[model samples]
Target: MAGGEETRKSTDSLAQESSIIDTFAPEARFECPICLAWLRDPVVTACGHRFCRGCIYSWLEREHACPVDNMKLDVEKDIFPDNFTRREISQQKARCPYIVRGCIEELSPLDVESHMIICKFRPPELPENEKLRCQFVDVGCTDKFEDEPELQRHLESEVTKHLSLLSQAYTKITISNQASTSAIAQQANFWDPPAKNEQVSTSEADEGVNALLRAMYEKIVVLEQKSREQDIIISNMSEQINSLNLSMSKMQLRHCNGCYLWYINDFKNKIKDMQKDHHLMFYSPGFYTSANGYKLCVRLNLSPRDPNYIAILIHMMKTEHDNTLEWPFSGRLSITVIHPIESYRNIKETMMTRPELEAFKRPVQDLNPRGFGYTEFVLVEDLKIQEFMRNNTLVIKVQAQPV
Candidate 1:
């Protein structure tokens, strides 16, 4: 019986403590309908309803009716401060919501809101299962994982891919930075300002001018360097194009059986220097006769050793397929000195090669010394006539026919 009575007394004490807490607890009427918390700065509506002044004011912005009664309300005239209700709430003692989290302080209604904002025990608004994104999101890593551990694992697994993306981004940034730096460097005014007249001195003026000139010179040098680089690249490309053309011509010559025509422009200018020089002669580069591969060239002497007239010659040259060709060549050649005036007839000359002629024979070396030609091909004075010289240019045409 003694043990049972002691147990009952312990239960009574617990019941009494619970009763005391209920007696001090804020009533539902003292709570705001919007926040469901003890009203702060309590205000009463025309319908005799109480709510926190801030809550009602914010609600009235989006609505005209009261949250509880759904009755029409006016924010400017229907709500009045209830100082009595505010005082009652402030006087009531409230246990901290974080009591379970080890908060030991008791607070009034007025201080609870401020405490909760800084409370360490407040539950996180976001759920723990929600994913976290990568810190490198700006660089294009869009990966999200359940938590920090998973995110770390993802980063480790994709390290190579991430590094490559970072490298590309870094390269772009570097290029942009270089361009910006170059632009800034070119603007001399951005770095130095003009001096005032009163502060100017002969030495100072000279230094400033020299600095400006130096900046200008540096910019010019950079531009000139870029221009030279571009020129070199263009020259290389031109050389390659010419090489390709020469190769294509050689290939076509191996299969072509048709006669080849050669046209030389600015003929007078080309021979003028040769005429003045003791050399007195000009030789064209070799060209193929036919697919059988007979190579020949045309030569001109402005002032021959004879000195009476202009000399013309035709000679044979070594060829890769010389062994496959007829030993002594037999062909016809035509040369025309075109008159600049369209009305004038062109001067023409023709020659028929024979197997017995040394000029028609296969070359022993790269070229032969003896060639077939007329020493008195044309009068030198006739070539100097105005009709043959137009705009300081002359045109010569040569055709080779292989039978």
Candidate 2:
């Protein structure tokens, strides 16, 4: 009976595969359904369909969709250029043969073969004058100029800004080193506590002041050595923990259905780092609600408007299933900042999607231009939420579902 069930399942999968194969032609990817020929200036619809530009215009004039699927297709809102398909078809047929040899040119398929014969061979590398970047790029100067004169002019004009960036970088390094030293000092304090002088005054007098000082000095030396050893061990342990955290971020702890948990490591340090680079953002790994469901990830950063709070935003990323998903997403998002030690103390915030707002609209770019979320999710120094972080790590859980 088990063997029969397995055979039936295998047979069902093969039948479905065969049906899909029948729906597409040998080179159906490049062929338009209406024109019965290779595609020319193709445009894709949000219905997970595409057509030649000329054919789509003709079809949309008569009805709102292609004759085959009849699914709704709007020219103004739903249609977009399929850049992948465009590049694939263009390069395969019209690209110059010497592009690999550094010939930066493309021609129509009819004229490509003849043009290749006359094209000159270009050197592998371009001249330095053709491309350049600021020398202070290491310290975070991201500016572009048209030419050498423009770059020189920018350098002359922005002397103060560049010097300030260098100073900030140096200051950050100093603070980081000092923080590490203070942490070691705290550990040493934990291991050694002073004797209660009130009760032991007479006992210390019997030992003599000079002799007692020598003993105390010797003990301090031993404790310092021991602290150094412990610091090395802790440094190694921190590296291992960092590697594990990276793995967890890339591939979550387990498969999720419609919820995701993001771990923000070194929370306090991140809050400090935000002061140096206001645009710095932390993105959680991407996840989906279900199979062929909405793809999303959380964007977190110190609130731009008010640095006292952190901003949490959700973005709708482009996926293969994007064209088929509902637009102006109607759902309720339940976001929670989980307490590391106590479950009951978790901070939960809820927001429902507003159809009138652009934040929940279908994505046009790789990630939607508009993100839906709270600007000030929580206060940075709230006493009740201080315990939400453990071992300097903060955890956030986000759940999305239809309203």
What ranges in model 1 sit over 4 Å off? 1-235, 245-279, 303-308
- What's the CA RMSD of model 1 in angstroms? 31.7
The model with the greatest lDDT is 2
Question: Roughly what TM-score does model 2 have, to 2 decimal places?
Answer: 0.37
Go through the candidates in order and give the clash count of each: 0, 0
What does the lDDT come to for candidate 1? 0.65
Residues 89-173, candidate 1: write the lDDT tens digits. 7778876555534566788866765786676754334333334555444445667654446767988889888787656544442
Off by over 4 Å in 2: 1-255, 383-385
Residue pairs of candidate 1 with colliding backbone atoms: none
Error of 1 at 301 (Å): 0.4
